[model samples]
Target: MKIVITGGAGFIGSNLARALTEQPRVTQIRVLDNLSTGHKPNIAGLDVDFFEGDIQNAVLLDQVLRDADAVVHLAALPSVPRSLRDPLASHHANTTGTLQVLDAARRAGDLYVIAASSSSVYGANPNLPKHEDLTPAPMSPYAATKLATEAYLSAYHHSFGLPVLSFRLFNVYGPGQRADHAYAAVIPKWVSATLAGQPVTVHGDGTQTRDFTYVGTVCRVFTNALLRRIIEPRPVNLAFGTRKSLLDLIPEIEVATGRPAHREHRVPRVGDVSHSQADSTRLLALFPEVTPVPINEGIAATVDWFRASAVIAASS
Candidate 1:
């Protein structure tokens, strides 16, 4: 099977590419990324045909999707703060880009398209253990874009007879997730800071919780979905029902890195959800083989990767 991954050089995308390479049934892996948020080195040493380009380009999308058995669309301008600052850019990249990719997939006959939507789409709903049936009340532009992404995939599946699956991903973290950016996720950013003897910034008094899913588990699910050719019109919550607060995570980081975290509490950023947890009933019913990695274990592995990365950077 030939698989094409959009934004396949980013954190999750690169990891997914690595996972697909090990599968015997996957014959070819093609990665399409513009490197705006993704690094080419992320997919380095992998057996993949890498195409550096934006998903907004129809010509480029057509070229990449041609003769592909499946397309895992993971490209987007991620981060709520970034989207709060510039809504149009987020819409263009996340919403419009998804439409373009869907059109390209329609052109490519009998292709299975799987895309990533975010748990943030459940913003302002104030529901614990968010389920697929809940009405999505997006607080920020980022969440809106993700909601649109899910909607587009459903539309394409029903209207155009396209086989598509949209997974509403929670906070996914692990190796290959970068810490250098201002919009970096909490795990990588905090782990990197604590390792560097710096204070880890805690937004919103560290009480806000998130259902953090390990990237390996996510990649495994994606691989399984591709191999099985799973198609669900409704967006499925991709995270297991495990909630962790920022306060709960700090000690785990301290334990893993063998260093105390100097936390600097600050005012919570706008458009940030207070808490998020997933109702994984649908996900489990579909992929019962998935076993979640414990938060402590995942944190330990993440710290090891950051430490190794620091060593590599210093040596270079």
Candidate 2:
């Protein structure tokens, strides 16, 4: 299979690239990344035709989409806090960029497009285990853009017969997650802080919960989504189908790192959801064989990677 992964240099995209490279059926893998938030080192040594560019570029999107059997669209400005700071930038990247991918795929014809949507689309709804059918009440600009993109995908599928699917990803984390950034996910941020003997900031008494899906599981689901055919462009939740409170996760992180975290409690920031979990019934109906890596196991792997990276940094 000939495939192109947009934002392929980013955390999840880079992991997906490596996974696809190991697959015997995948003949070619092309990557397009703007490197805005993606690191150059992420895609290093990977067997891929890498293109450094933005997905908003029509010519670039057209060039990359040509002859590709499928395009896993993972490009976006992802972060609720950052989105709150600058909604326009997030909209341009998440919303406009997604539309460009859909349009390019439509023009390309015969190419399947699977996009990365966020569970944040559900916003702060008090509902537990959010289903795909839930009315999305996006609180942040980032969530709003993701919700809009999903709408575009569904519209394109119905109006133009475009083969498309959108995965409403939960809190994905694992190795390769950037910890040097201000917008890093909680797992990587806390892991880094714990390892460095710094105080890990816990927002809102650390009681807020999230369906912390590991990156490997996410990649596996994305690969499956590529090979499978679902006629509807309905956004399916891709997660471990389990939720963990931030407080609950800290102990596991401490165990993984063999150290205690100096935690500083603070009020939760604006746009932060109190609780989030996924109802994976829609996903399981399609990929029943999918099994999630236990959160403890994933924590161990992530902590080990960060420790090893720190060692490498110290040596250099």
Best candidate (score: TM-score): 1
Error of 2 at 313 (Å): 2.3
Error of 1 at 124 (Å): 0.3
> Model 2 over residues 1-316: C-alpha lDDT tens digits?
8999999999999999999998888999999999998887888899999999999999999999898899999999999999999999999999999999999988888578889899999996788889999889999999999999899999998988888888999999999997898899999999999988998999888888999998999989888776664545899999856989999998999999999988899888899888999999998988898899999999999998898888888998
Cα miss at 239, model 1 (Å)? 0.7
Best-fitting candidate, scored by lDDT: 1
Query: What TM-score would every model get versus the actual structure?
Result: 0.99, 0.98
TM-score: model 2 vs. ground truth? 0.98
For model 2, the local distance difference test gives 0.91
